[model samples]
Target: MTPSAEILAFMGRLGHDFARPEFLVRALTHGSIASATRPDNQRLEFLGDRVLGLVMAEALFHADTQASEGQLAPRYNALVKGETCAALARQIGLGEVLKLGRSEMLSGGRRKEALLADGMEAVIAAVYLDAGFETARRVVLNLWRDRLDTIEDDPRDPKTALQEWAQANGMKPPAYEQTGRGGPDHAPVFHITVRLDNGETAAAQGSGTKRSIEQAAARTLLERLEGRE
Candidate 1:
């Protein structure tokens, strides 16, 4: 079957041309709009998650041959995390091509981070199925080239890093508190504060989710603690 103009344009952005375009279509199909004939992308997302993990692990292993597993683990997580996938999806305009149900579309499903991340993973699975591991790996590496190059600079998750810092400094683990919340229910904002036993603290707000706000707060606190802010 001939691919639509939009799919073709998306392919250009994705840096891959699908031999079986149906896979691409299914990758973009959310469960909300799925039927017996038109399957959703959940299975593809699952497969792609593993594929992405393997690709990232291999890339990190080879990129820093001298680094220990402890050092590489955080870097691997930073590269293959759902947030990273969502950011990459946004770069390629993946949300614009997603096939969502009316309810999901009305609820701003296109902009949802989880949905976009899942779609990105499904797309990777599609690429893997359409071609092979080599082609999928090439596409993943190409899409993540910038991130991969910079992953060594600050690869640890903010919360994890903050906890480790506290432990190393003979302090208790950092405490995260939900200070407040605002905005409408559909688009609520979370306010989080991360405080250390040393009486240092940082606050941040996130429109994305509670966990994101916590991470933001942790990052701010970490930066302040390290005198990098």
Candidate 2:
């Protein structure tokens, strides 16, 4: 079911109000759905990307007075990045509202991280356009406030960090290979493998917006290696 009024009311408690219900509808629409039958979400996705930037900027500035652009940039990226957005989407049960084409639905597109992330971004943008900046910022912070509070500096992508760890150990650099991917064009998976030069291989699975699956794959490999020792 499209997110019902109760669901929206619950979302409102998170600080999001839809001035344009149509935009909200578009944000939840996937391209796979027939254009005539379902409102396409791509446009809102585009707008949402920008809205996310503004909202995040406001959030960083509003929440922390000491943060400079350098520090704020990474934090903002972590919050608004595709993987982060997907995680937030799932937390709010956004997946339950998406409308997909028969093919996409059959392919389990409703639960895709990519789709959810994009839709969430679109939704953020839509909210900004419908209402104003402060409201949108509130919406973002309400959903992501906890994550923001728990923020840490990862410094490097997990793959890069993993490779550095392997190389310093006199171990050959780790190799990564894609195993599989599935989901809508906007959101796809890259199942990956991380291997050490020692002929040891480890596998892991994760879902997200960017190469998050790779991060999971790398973390998995690291844990398995640690476990073996």
Candidate 3:
């Protein structure tokens, strides 16, 4: 899709406008692709991670007047988790539009949750810097309403969540296929294929975001895929 149309659709879903179209493009650029394509989004990704944390923490802390410092931690974790970000990316059709390196593309980086999740955060950071704080808040909060909707007021380990779901369904705990790795020798994205006893499978991309979170998504996707079996 044309960048203009893509940005418009993203903005429509996000309920905000780009203060600078350039930031949006830069945010969309991935390191894998940017080495050849142009500017990289990794720097933007770093900025967005902090911006999202601050904004989400602010919203969680202020939205509920009675929440203790302890109560807000879990809520923040759930909201900023990689799965949440990946869901947001899929919502905006980011997967289909990402410009990835040939190796990353061949290895499924375009559909990798790690990449999508990081890209979304980078986009948020870019929006905030390009526009302003409130605009970024509007965009992030609007899409993350579901997270706010189910604020348990505490943190729950997603790995635990997956185990609970499995046990509830009388199924064995999930198993992960450690497929391979990507990125530089020092930093690598771990590829895992989650499978269940019910003959279903789904892929997960795990890395520095949190190994447990990626495992949870893999487990969740495995169960989701199981329903179709």
Candidate 4:
């Protein structure tokens, strides 16, 4: 099949025209729609994940001259995590260019955070393959400019913080339970409740996935307990 105008438009938005157009096509192809001639983006995603990590690490390290390893680590994790990738994908309209199978399309695969995140990574790999690491690094730095600029210093994972708080207060570890799921299989919403042994609890719904929903619930509980909310 011919690549759609939308795909070209997305490439323009990404600020990189493919040297090999097929790389872009393959990057946009989801696993559910993969064929012998139309390979999926999983391999590209793998490479792109590394590329993204390296770029983020370098950027973070340089951005903060005095930040210890401990401070830089969590900031790196937060920037490279799936949720952040998905948000970046949405910023570039990556979901609009994705090629998905019929079932996935019907099930809202384009909106699924997992798919979007993977697609973003695949696109990064595609850019690297088309040009070089320098080009890919430039693209990533440009795309992630705002996030990198505004990233929290000494970021802490909410779940870890919550667990630490629980232990400090002599309460059992926080327990997370899935309370509900809705929407299609591919784009399901997850509702989760995080409860501490001491009776503090918070519930939250997220469109990302079970892990994101659970994280959100944990963060909400942490905020509530800490009186931040």
Candidate number with greatest lDDT: 1
Candidate models: Cα lDDT each: 0.92, 0.74, 0.76, 0.90
User: lDDT tens string, model 4, 1-229?
Assistant: 4656887799899999887888899999999999998899999999999999999999999999999998999899999999899999999999898999999899888888889999999999999999999999999999999999999985677888899889998988889998898976766778899998867789999677788778888888888878853
Tens digit of per-residue lDDT, candidate 1, span 129-181: 99999999999999999998987745788898899999999999999999999
* Model 1 bad stretches (over 4 Å): 169-172, 197-200
Q: Which run of 10 residues does model 3 get worst, by summed lDDT?
A: 206-215
Full candidate order by lDDT, most accurate first? 1, 4, 3, 2
User: On lDDT, who's better, 1 or 4?
Assistant: 1
Q: Which number leads on TM-score?
A: 4
The model with the greater lDDT, 3 or 4, is: 4
Q: Which 10-residue window of candidate 4 scores lowest in summed lDDT?
A: 1-10
Each candidate's TM vs. the true structure? 0.91, 0.74, 0.68, 0.92
Residue pairs that clash (backbone atoms under 3 angstroms), model 2: none
TM-score ranking, best first: 4, 1, 2, 3
Instruction: Write one digit per residue (lDDT tens) for candidate 3, span 1-229.
Output: 2357777777666666675677878888888777554788888899898888988999887899898877788789988988789888988877776777788887777677788998899889888987888888888888888778777854576565656667888999877667777875434667767666777666667554447536656656845755666
Output candidate 3 Cα RMSD.
Answer: 8.2
Q: Candidate 2 clash total? A: 0
Quote the positional error of residue 37 for candidate 1 in Å: 1.7
For candidate 2, the C-alpha RMSD (Å) to the true structure equals 4.9
